[model samples]
Target: MKDFQPQNEEVKAIRVLLHGPVGAGKSSFINSVNSVLQMRMTNEALASSTTSDQSFTIKYQTYKIKKEGKENIYPFVFNDVMGLEEKTGVKEEDIKLALKGHVKDGYKFNPVSSLSDGDHGYNSSPSISDRVHVLVCIYDANASEMKEPVLQKMKKIREAASELEKLYYPS
Candidate 1:
């Protein structure tokens, strides 16, 4: 995997990461946002893995939401990844991949077996010129508790985002 680095400090990309545990309202939230905004969806959600599974979002998808009564278009990309399980071991790679671009035509991704050990799918780095935006972490309202693991995951995500921001915008 390439070292985590930023390429530019001028271009800002409106990148929003939607993460949550399994059965969270991530997919539904994306759909609802799309519907309410009446934005033209430029891309569809992809399977997170090659294997046929109910929960895996195979591909990272992008959607374009036009501003309300404006000529400008806002591009929103939402990636639905596999949930955080004890043995899946694909967190880091999945996170990096989500930050990367979507799957190419006929290109296949390697399934991750270790959380931190996997290929960084895209070479794209964060850019300050690209408006790197928000990360919305969804949660199941019915979950039993926000235990240790859950809290840890949230912390890591925030840390990663902060680091990225620093890299992209050194102010």
Candidate 2:
């Protein structure tokens, strides 16, 4: 949302994390949203041009919409993560770490390992602004069906988010 103000002073903007299968248009969606906000076609986040199964995005990146006027940036921000593949893409553990705001921006996705507390990219004490306010799982309608392993990975990520919700909004 443009020019939106949060009721809580601690929150500067809402962070949204977008994740999905490889070539599922995660980056494309970000570009589209930015294009609409800037009123021009621009591809700040590079979308996959190749047909390979590997993910085009390999690092965590945050995208902010900047307007020309006084209200420079929108109150909503987006974080694009590496696409998930059945077996060789982003690991579920890394995604879980990201949801909890442990993974920092520009941190390269290892795929083989998750970010530990001691890692430089790991944020041990993430503030409200650093935490992900929304988790968006993009599903490709063009696909025949979601693979079993990828679906399972997404399920685990969803569970992690749910558990994080408990920590943030405990009853």
Candidate 3:
């Protein structure tokens, strides 16, 4: 993989977006990827189960994987979003904006408020290198059933990713 590199010098890291229901292990997934890349166990991304209804992750965080003993980081980044809830979760509008590369990293999300152009974290014009190239939807297989609203939101997000010509992978 080290030998394989993007042909274009202008191309930066490939951004992969992780999104799913609360407690779906999105953060854990990122940590695992990092661990594998670094060849050791890591807890760089906070991941914990919560009894409360709110999401454990409240901001848009990006995780970079650096190979062991390598000075350069991998040509990829995993972007984790707030876990989705049945009623109170990341706004679909905000997700769409993110898919289109309008949202920036480290942006805090308000469960009750959707992001807009006026937001300080908003990026009016993001280059292709800043856009998400892949979207991964995580789900808990043991869950009895998926909520209708949440399912609908996932579908909308998939559609939005499609509109942005991004890849959508279900996990």
Candidate 4:
């Protein structure tokens, strides 16, 4: 992978966005990727296997995976969003804005509210580096089916992502 270089030098890293239902192992996936890249078991990102229905992640976070004993950062960045819930969860509008690079990192996501134009965390314009280059929708294999609301939200998100010409991967 080290030999692989981005076609656009203006963008330092390829941003990957991960979206899925609550407790769908998004955080665990990030941790596992980081651990594998570093050749060690690491838990830099918080992950839980609890059965609680409440969402554990609350903010938009970008994680950088670095190889052990190296000062250079990886060419890829993984962005994690608040998990989606049946009744209340990450707003669909917010996800759309995020795909367009309007949502900034560290923005606290409110389940009851969507981001507004005047919000302090909102970025009117973001560079290509800040935009998501790839969108990944994670589904639990153990689950028989997804809730209607959650599925609708995912569909909308996929449409928005497609409009932005971002690579979409369902896993």
- Measured against the true structure, the TM-scores of the candidates, in listed sequence, are 0.61, 0.95, 0.90, 0.91
Greater TM-score among 3 and 4 belongs to 4
Ranked by TM-score, the better of candidates 1 and 2 is 2
All models, RMSD in angstroms: 8.0, 1.2, 3.6, 3.5
Q: For model 4, how does the per-residue alpha-carbon lDDT over 1-171 read when each residue is reduced to its tens digit?
A: 555567899888998899999888888899988888788898877877684577788888999987444547788988888888888879988888888788989999988889988899899878988888989987778976898999999999998888677343453
What lDDT would each prediction earn against the true structure? Answer: 0.49, 0.89, 0.83, 0.84
* Sequence-dependent TM-score of model 4: 0.91
Tell me the tens digit of each residue's lDDT in model 3 across 64-164. Answer: 88765564788888898988898787888888888778888899988888988878989999887778888999987887688888899999999888766
Better of 1 and 4 by lDDT: 4
Weakest 10 consecutive residues of candidate 4 by summed lDDT: 162-171
What does candidate 2's lDDT look like per residue over 88-155, in tens digits? Answer: 88999998888878899999998887789999899999888988889999988978889999999999
Better candidate number, 1 or 2, judged by lDDT = 2
> What TM-score does prediction 3 earn?
0.90
Better of 3 and 4 by lDDT: 4
lDDT of 1 by residue, 6-72 (tens): 3343323355667766556566666666666664552244323232213454344444444554445
Between candidates 2 and 4, the one scoring higher on lDDT is 2
TM-score of 1: 0.61
